[model samples]
Target chain A: MVFSRYNSSHSTAPSAPELPPESYHQPQQQQYQSYYGQPSSIYGQSGGFPAGTQPDVVRAFQMVDRDRSGFIDEHELQQALSSGYQRFNLRTIRLLMFLFKNPYDSLRIGPAEFASLWSCLGHWRAIFERFDRDRSGKIDSMELRDALYSLGYAVPPSVFQVLISKYDNGTGKAGLDFDSFVECGMIVKGLTDKFKEKDKEYRGSATLSYDSFLCMVIPFLVSYD
Target chain B: MVFSRYNSSHSTAPSAPELPPESYHQPQQQQYQSYYGQPSSIYGQSGGFPAGTQPDVVRAFQMVDRDRSGFIDEHELQQALSSGYQRFNLRTIRLLMFLFKNPYDSLRIGPAEFASLWSCLGHWRAIFERFDRDRSGKIDSMELRDALYSLGYAVPPSVFQVLISKYDNGTGKAGLDFDSFVECGMIVKGLTDKFKEKDKEYRGSATLSYDSFLCMVIPFLVSYD
Candidate 1:
């Protein structure tokens, strides 16, 4: 019912790719292939969704692109996500935009880009729910630590301080809600991915020159702005 | 045979506390009580060794205090630990001293303090071995992450960089051997424990005024020197 509210009969929108009626029954691996081949290096690793999730992503994009413009900006993304998940604040939405920036247009993500972003968000949402074990709608530092551990990132407690200082919901509380958790997970994952790019041997150390290091890291730092 | 090398027929040393010959047969919990009530708050939380471990700690201390002075300095600690565990470097020994400083003497730890410190190291050693899954005698960044995670610290990948830069054994390679790993663990554990004291609600955060916060934190930063 929540999704139907955003449907404007734009199911016939041609800018969005057409889904074959029989595509759902095809081999599951082939359907997820469409979600890949995007320009998102930060998310490239987590590309490809579980089988049968493609249409739902496309439908979500269609619902948010209520004007049938074939594209949706941060506001539309927020509305689309709120309908499907919960409301995500503007700052987190902006950070998501910075991370999943649409290659064709900086201001909006099209069908393919939206699918990629949604898949990534779904991945993070699962992680967020798993670590929010207290069901408190947020995760404390210990939970955050465990969540990051499961992702193969062992951050120090000091990093917890930095994360809370940056991503806490400004409500004078200590934990992170879903939106902020996603934002935090993305930044850490992004930075680690960036680092791992240089650490190809996976020895956990890299030898990048000063300029090269700055160029690699500066974008993630300033992306939300 | 390795321990016999350090034995100097000083088991009768009078300065160290006398161990009742039959203490070993007592209930397991009672044997561990002597390891607690130390002045080292950082290690107090980890006080008490496993059952029947007290005699081993005392024997290790006696072996190192060859002069029968009832106290061991950094050199003696290095010798003592090397006898039981892998040889710990002087720097790590000094870090241990800083963390488990003797109440009556800054430069040395007597039998009681030594027991507390040993039990804490045993705790960390078990953690270190568990995460060093490859049994490589050292842990790369990923393993370090798991180690810290087990200890309730989820540091950022960036902190791993800091730790590697600081504790990477000066070998031009990344990864920390036992000594450096222990040093890293203690500093992180110490800082986290301090923070948790003020974060009484376990919310992963605490609010402190400028001076109080600095006083709480600066010591951990400068303690090595």
Candidate 2:
């Protein structure tokens, strides 16, 4: 499988800090298991790490905050995530920074935000593994759809086309590497979540006035700005 | 989920020939568990049955082949399937007949074809369950994509639009019930399998001359005629 090809290098990284397989140590596993898991509240409230996962999250932060700074920028966040998990693309790293931006520093994430981000990644990892059924370190269009479906969105084929084009590996191969996969998943997820806030009845459609719609979309548009 | 509304009646049916849960007793369960599971060859040779699953398949055939004419037409096939599984749409039943037409009767399937069809449905059922994560008795566009992914096809979102539109419930519910879901799945699986025959290396692209492409698609176009 393609996963073997990609995971082979990281399997032997000498200094990489390893967290236990998600099933092993996390007591609150079930609480935040889904892609739309409980972390939204946790994220909004700037809560600390879920009880059992703190040590691992803190250790990863300290490793990347090499200068003993209280926060890690995109480069450090990338290093921190890669050492503990798969390497994230710079675009995804920036997206994460934007989502989990520190209150005091717009360019970086602090411990609480970092912890929230890590917890969120754990959920995304679970989702990624579920859809990457071939263990190919990436998901093709079919896998992407399945991932989106599990999250309760019945997107059209056009959605897949746009996502594949956006997240393509650039090798002309139609697959999304881990970083791109998570980014795509989060995009679908984040948007669906936002839409659902308006679709309180779960009717699979929502009505948003112009300003209301812009408020929902502008965050994503300006995130990189 | 919506499944409760759709499945509750069938759950209480008096004559339903309940097959054991897929995990229960079938020895050959693992052999044919995938959407592209081993039944293709089993299907090609007009083989009798996969050894351990014979009884259930035979029983289903006998129950549907009520006249004992060693044959069951579309209506009978639909009845048999709905009893053993969920109700399949007539269009899907027609699609099945087109694919598994009896040697002596173009409008129906015989014992061997019926057995093959049953086995194939078992595999589709497993896939349906996996992607119907919400147990809504239907798969939305997202669920549809996940199902396709498991079968190794990464379709674009536009494919979802086409499929969701094609297989839609007509209730404006942007979802596919079991019958429509199976039809959609089979269409994708059958096409991929056919294409794979030409592209042995699985390069995610295939080259076919004009005649070859026509030969590949003409059957589906002309199947109903």
* TM-score of every candidate's chain A: 0.65, 0.63
Per-residue CA lDDT of model 1 for B1-225, tens digit only, reads 111111112212211111222333243234233434533432233233333456667677777767655567888998888766877866567667756764444567665556667767777788888877889888887788677666555555554554544433334345777777777776665555555556555444454432233334333322111
Give the backbone clash total of model 1: 5
Instruction: Flag regions of model 1 displaced more than 4 Å.
Output: A1-51, A66-69, A165-173, A223-225, B1-225
TM-score of 1: 0.37
lDDT for each residue of candidate 2 in A150-211, tens digit (9 for 90 to 100): 54434455445545543443233467666776666555545544554665554444444322
DockQ for every model, please.
Answer: 0.01, 0.01
